[model samples]
Target: MSSQSRKKWTGYAITSAIIISLMIITIGIYSFEEENLKNIITKNQVEIQEIITKSISKNISSELELITFELALLAESGQLQDDLGTKESNQLISQTFDRLNSISPTAQILALDKDFKVLSQASKIHNSFVGATVKGLPDLIDSEENKTKSESKILSINTSLFDEPEIAITFPIVNKETNISNGLLLVTLPSSEFFKRHGNIYDVESQFLMVMDENNVLLIHPNMENVGKNFFDDEIQHDISYNSALNEYITHVLEGNLSTVIVTLEDNIGERINSAIPVTVNGKNEFVFGVVTPTQSINQEIDEIIFLTKIQTVFLLMSTIAVLLVFMLKRSQSFKKEKLTVIGQLSSNIAHDIRNPLGTIKNAGVIIEKENNSQNKIISREINRINLSVRRISHQIEEVLNYVRTTPMILKQHSISQTIQEAVDTLDVPPDIKINIPNNDVSIRIDHEKMLIVFVNIVLNAIQSIGKNEGNVTISIRETFSNVTIEFENSGPNIPAKDLKHIFDTLFTTKLEGTGLGLSSCKNIIEQHKGTIHVVTNPVMFSIKLPNEHSNTE
Candidate 1:
């Protein structure tokens, strides 16, 4: 082989070896990071589901509690007695019924005597009420709990007085002196009313919610026909033995503890994820709320995690390889060479711009010196301020031209206030733009010249962001026990969301004529001093935090 061919092959072999090593290292890293990513995604998805479940339970429980309270209050009013159905009794009952009628138009109220017979009612039975009866009225008496039963006061899924199913809330009117019951009052609103009220609480993913009463009978279902049926028997069914995994999961929940469960339908509707939580009605845990959704809801989170992991893995792998390849290809001509080339060009251009301003300053100075020689020299103060602004512009230009990845620093104890004033004295600010500086100053160990650059760049950016608008730029210092933060806030348009993250990135700028090195240089300077710089949008702000040793100089 020719000498050139041999050398080329040698280079190729070295590159292959390096690539193999990187691939092995990256595979190990990818395995670790992928697992971490899955855990994070799954944790976030469960948190969101828990929040939705809590909201559904709270909404349904609140509505039931309110209805029960209203029913108990009107029942204890001491007007409708057990023996008579008088005009005075009907009128008193109808007034309260009429008020609640606005919410449930078909709601009915009935007063039953001790014999469980309807004594008086403002229902649709009319005056033929001598011997009226209901289909499911006996269950509301709850005779098992003696005279102190509270299950009778809960919202029960019953359909006694109406043609269809209704939500019944019954309260007993007991004689307080005897500690015994006289009669009871029952009020039932339509099941559709409960469904209509709590169903639309969220237009989000918690759509498939099953509501059941204290007896485990389904109160509200998407299929209204399924209401008033046993939830464990009809809605949930395990294909195998009672000792199966799914059955065990269900038993765990029946044992009054929350557990995650997966159920597969025998009808091939596919697997579903279920989360069940108890609902509180009238200050008691008397109902069940279950959220059932398709398995794709969980798979979707997995898919997203996979997509994000792939993106991160590819980015890390490509960046590592690309840096190596670019270095090899440009060994004779490097990135630093190109950077210096740009810096040299900037220096020449900025130096030329500085000449005109220097000439103006020199002329102003000569006028003062010559006036002083006349022995009656009256030097204008305006000339001095203009000279100071011109000098500041020159100093900032040098900072931009000398910009590299890092700048050497000399740390000394100095007041942040002194550095800020010096930085602002260099800028030719517009009259319409107001600048406010804090009176309380804090000192820190920082490089004075480099720190001045950070402050100057921040203030100049704020002024430019305001443009011709009348805006205020406020600067303040907040000191903690170990660190002091200097903040710059401006009443300008908020930074766009898309560009906020890349604000300090090298060569990233929104301005048409910007070199994009001002903030980037500031970031480097702050970092070199072992400090951090951060920004927040919506009334743009920049905060620079530096280590402090309680250095306060009044």
Candidate 2:
């Protein structure tokens, strides 16, 4: 070989080496940035969740204070004066009960004799105890000194009911004029109302709040179906906290200190987060209000932010590596061809790697379709959906490789309606499922292949959700001068509100057989094409939106 040719070849080899080295470095940086972003987002989310939980606790405490004050004022009113006789005293008692009932939905006023037997009841009727003696009135009830001087003592007592776990505020009605006691005026409030009122003030979702009494009995449940059921009933196990945590909380609050505790409980379904707050009434600590929200709710938003941050970081690192590769290529003369060849090889490998899985999925579907039995029919349908997902994933990989292997290209214009139609056509949906698309064509600038993958994956998801039920899938497309918007909707059981934010996250699928990568990949592809995807789900409907911007034609 000539000296010049040899020199050129040597230069080319060095340049190729440098380009490959840059690519390797860029991939490493992408990985690092992804991890760092995840960490930061996770930390921030933890802090935010803590703030929200503490705010909820403080709000509950404030509301309890208000209730206590109202009860105190009602007890001090002069209507319980002894000189008023039975007629005036009864009127006073009736009027007081009416006011209490109006102010507190859960309030109950009880008039008890010196021995704590039932006398008159106000508010809701309680036939179980209308004439029954109070067998479990606490020692504080009988210890009032004014009972010796008259019939009752004006002593404030905080105790729980024997039949149920309710905290009552009992004060003796003593006439100031006679300086003598009459009967005990008991104002009973259920722990459920305490939590409910607090939840109302915060507008918290029902599932996110719960109240358990000191006995660990579920007095207040967001799901009204569980109300009045004991927390330790057959459905739930209470060993998580037992009674120690509740005791600690009550003791601290009774000493005028605020405390917070977190415990985990295993229910029929799964584990849940339980936050307990001790509520002190009238200088006595007898009840604890708890708020239990699922850990999934706290972690979901964080995961999304982390996922997006990781994607952005990966892109930035890739860009940096691309710049370095270009610099190496431009500096050498003979290495350009070799570098181009290497890029082509990498792109081919990525495509091949993606296509292999897709082929397997397709083969699985073909096999499933030949099966005859009903059970086999169900299995075949699921396998076919899996096949479609694999194909969708391969398409996404191809789009990414295409971008990596070439310079920027002009966006192609296509009919949005037609694109969605093609996507729906590709899905192996059940025979009972129906799809509706508008007749009018809406055009938008997008990478046709990439957009098709996004549309197909999303639509397939909707169809699968419809399953064997007689259900409908609706696709609506709208276009503006700069952007095109498409909405795919379906009828299905509502995705729990708590799980909505996590549906797109990696490894977060609700399906038993799902790998949890399809939606995450879809999100990556949509963002790569400078578009957005969102989901809205309710009991009767589930919808997805894809909005894309038109590239400038200039």
Candidate 3:
């Protein structure tokens, strides 16, 4: 009786122990699965959020480009340069700027001299910006060619009439005669209010997009109260802990060491992902784009995944998956390097890599032409073809770089007839061809260097089309109160009707050696000047009609 009772009790004890062990193991498995799941989801969300952030950056850049373009058109339309510093010109320019579709009503649009003294400003708050000295803008006028691409700026944290910080976008006014920047057409808006107007990122769920300065102050935020929120203030307490990683991130931001990154932090809802990228202005980090988004939804997904699985044994999996997990973690880390950095590096590297060999090939062709001076038909023709091929490659390189290097037009007043004559003077015109200069000159505002390029390209094309034949390229200019028309009448054979329609189309060309970019670039330059270009077949004339914009100043 005693042995039987003891055996039954032993059996109950062992079964209870087994049940306890199973429960403990199940809890461990679920906990491990949740960690891994959140990691995977965080990585995916980081990529998507990074893409979203870049889009915001691009939209910012696009906004600047738009405002800059509008200012350029004002000059091209005969409005700004001549009467600068005059109240009427200021009123006209400011009024036009205020009406532009891209900026918010609170934006400040202004014109300033090279000394940073404001000539005029348009604003909803006050007209005080007209006489204020723009304290913090980098000297864009005398900077090297590389720095010219940067047209964006963030004015000092100094408060304005609206009691908000400012972000400025400028288009330089260059004096063509002296090749110096004379003034700038600028548009600025309250930094905090700027992001609210961007349709993509205003109020999306629990996500917050912000701009912070090196002083740890949030210069821009969707909430006006958050605009001055500083990360380092000891008197203020935040819902989220702002120690360790955050302070480190601030250091990285102030150091201007990062382009893009996703910062992980402990949140009330388990965890959150926040990213920040420096807004580079004139080669320095003036502000940062900080994106904060929650990761709590990912935990719910993990719970559902674990609950839905009926039969799952993951005990052996954890032991063997360490290396694979490490690899994945590394791959995720690599994504932090971001898209812009990669693409910019790749394109520049490819250009350099391609051009080095092209130069070698060009040098080799020259050596071949000189070393083997045989006048035999095959050798002579082969050398000629080699030279032509070298030229073609060189032209192709220029075309690609031109696309990469193209910047917004800088408008200045110049004479159309003089520009044409200057272009013709640079060319090695054949003895049989006559380039006739017109007696009448027309003054128009334009980007002189770009116009010079346009004129040179068109005249070169005409000369090449004439080849060895005797021909006339008669230049004519006619001006009216509103517009100026310049024509080039060449004796070359009539261009095919089919080609005439597509003449200005990008990458449209009939020549075996042409890059097809010359005419398209010319067309772009003309359009940028608020002008139009067209070709006629009868005399193969290319005509350009530009707005009669003029400036009467030194």
* Runs with alpha carbons beyond 4 Å of true place in candidate 1: 10-35, 81-84, 98-106, 119-131, 143-151, 158-165, 175-182, 190-196, 202-207, 220-227, 234-259, 262-272, 293-295, 301-305, 308-554
lDDT of 3 by residue, 1-554 (tens): 69999999999999888766765665675567557766776776677566555545544544444455566665544456564687677778766765563234346677888788888777666557777787756553333233453243444344545565666556776654555666777776666556544423322332267677645677765445655667577622353355566667667766755434444544443455666666554355556776666556656755565554414443335422532454365456556544433433333444445654665676677777677777567876887787777665665665544433335477776777888889998777999999999998877778887898788888889998999999999889988777788898899999998888999876688888776778888888888888899999888999999877642331
Q: Pick the candidate with the highest TM-score.
A: 1
Q: Show the lowest summed lDDT stretch of 10 residues, model 1.
A: 234-243
Candidate 2 Cα misplacement greater than 4 A, ranges = 1-78, 83-87, 124-132, 138-164, 177-179, 210-276, 305-314, 317-554
Give the Cα error of residue 322 in candidate 1, in Å.
16
TM-score of each: 0.47, 0.42, 0.44
Tens-place lDDT digits, model 2, residues 1-554: 99999999999999888877765766676566445544444444333333434444544443344444444444456654433225565566567666655444444666666667766666564443446567657475555433343222222223344233454656665656665556566666655554555454333455666555444455656555665565555544243346565456545643544445444454442434444455443334434555555555544644554344444433445555544443343334225433433433444445444444455566557766656444776786687677667765665564444333222324677777888889888766777888898777776667776677677767777776777899988877776666666777788777887889898775577877555656766776677666677787764333333444434653
- Candidate 1 local Cα displacement, residue 141, angstroms: 3.2
Which prediction has more favorable TM-score, 1 or 3?
A: 1
What is the lDDT for 34 in model 2?
A: 44
TM-score of 3: 0.44
TM match of model 2 to true structure: 0.42
lDDT of 1 by residue, 228-252 (tens): 7765673444332232665565556
In order, the Cα lDDT scores of the candidates are: 0.65, 0.56, 0.64
Q: How big is the positional error of residue 13 in model 2, measured in Å on the Cα after superposition? A: 8.3
Instruction: Report the number of backbone clashes for model 1.
Output: 0
